[model samples]
Target: DTAVSQTPKYLVTQMGNDKSIKCEQNLGHDTMYWYKQDSKKFLKIMFSYNNKELIINETVPNRFSPKSPDKAHLNLHINSLELGDSAVYFCASSQLKGTDLYEQYFGPGTRLTVT
Candidate 1:
């Protein structure tokens, strides 16, 4: 079983288009997050959900939204996608409290390209 799965590992689309990226995790963890890694390899946390509740949200554009139907799934939808959004999007998860450690396991990542 996959710990985390994201569809369409690579996506290429024209600017101003709309797209959605699906993600799921089977780790039975309480917290899940979405992070966007820039071309420079800097990872920025975008959204975090705990048991279908939005917890952490960074300063992201309104065009981007995160949906978590259940504890195992978190999806990202983008409107008016821009070239600046062309980066690797990663889905991660971790426990809210455990082992005195805050470790996050990341998915392989979905590479989105806006043309």
Candidate 2:
């Protein structure tokens, strides 16, 4: 079984379109995250959810939203998509085992292209 999975691996749309990507994890981890990989291959954390409460990174825009319906699922919604928003979105799950140790497992990623 896949530890983490994302649906609609590829998305192609025009600017101003709204889209959502769904992610599911079977690893039983309490913390899940959404990351965006830019054209320069810089991966940045957009949001983090621990037990369904959101902890969004300050740099992320309000147009991006992350929802975790449960511990095993995290979904990302983007409103009024822009060309600069085109990037690979990754879903990850990590467990806080001890004081400050965490091992994150990432999904394949969903590539979104906006025209």
Candidate 3:
């Protein structure tokens, strides 16, 4: 079984449109995260939710929002999509082990294209 899954594996939308991507995890992890990988393959964490509480990364714009309905699910909402927003979005979950160590597992990823 897949530990993490994301809906709408591919999203193609026009600039200025709004879209949302849903993610679910069965790993029983306490922390979940949303990451964006640019065309250059540089991955950056957008947001993180620990037990359903939001922790936004400073570099992520306000146009992107992450909502966690529960510990097992985290959704991402993007308002006013732009060409720069085209990237692969990945959903990940992690469990904190002893002494600040963490092991994170990632979903297949959702590819978003903005035209």
Candidate of highest lDDT: 1
Better by TM-score, candidate 3 or 1: 1
Model 1 residue 114 lDDT score: 97
Candidate 1 vs candidate 2: which has greater lDDT? Answer: 1
Per-residue lDDT for 37-91 in model 1, tens only? 9999999999999989999999999999999999899999999999999999999
Q: What's the distance in Å from true for residue 26, model 3?
A: 0.5
lDDT of 2 by residue, 35-87 (tens): 99999999998989888988656588889988889989999999999999999
| Candidate 3 vs. true structure, TM-score | 0.94
The TM-scores of all predictions, comma-separated, are 0.95, 0.94, 0.94
Estimate, for each residue in 1-115, the C-alpha lDDT of model 3 and write its tens digit: 9899999899999999999999999988878999999999999988889898876565888899889999999999999999999999999988755643257899999999999
Question: lDDT for each of the candidates?
Answer: 0.93, 0.91, 0.91
Regions of candidate 1 where Cα sits further than 4 Å from its true position? 99-101
Ordering by TM-score: 1, 2, 3
What is the C-alpha local distance difference test score of candidate 3? 0.91
lDDT of 3 at 100: 32
The 10-residue segment with the lowest total lDDT in model 3? 95-104
Model 1 global lDDT (CA atoms, 0 to 1):
0.93
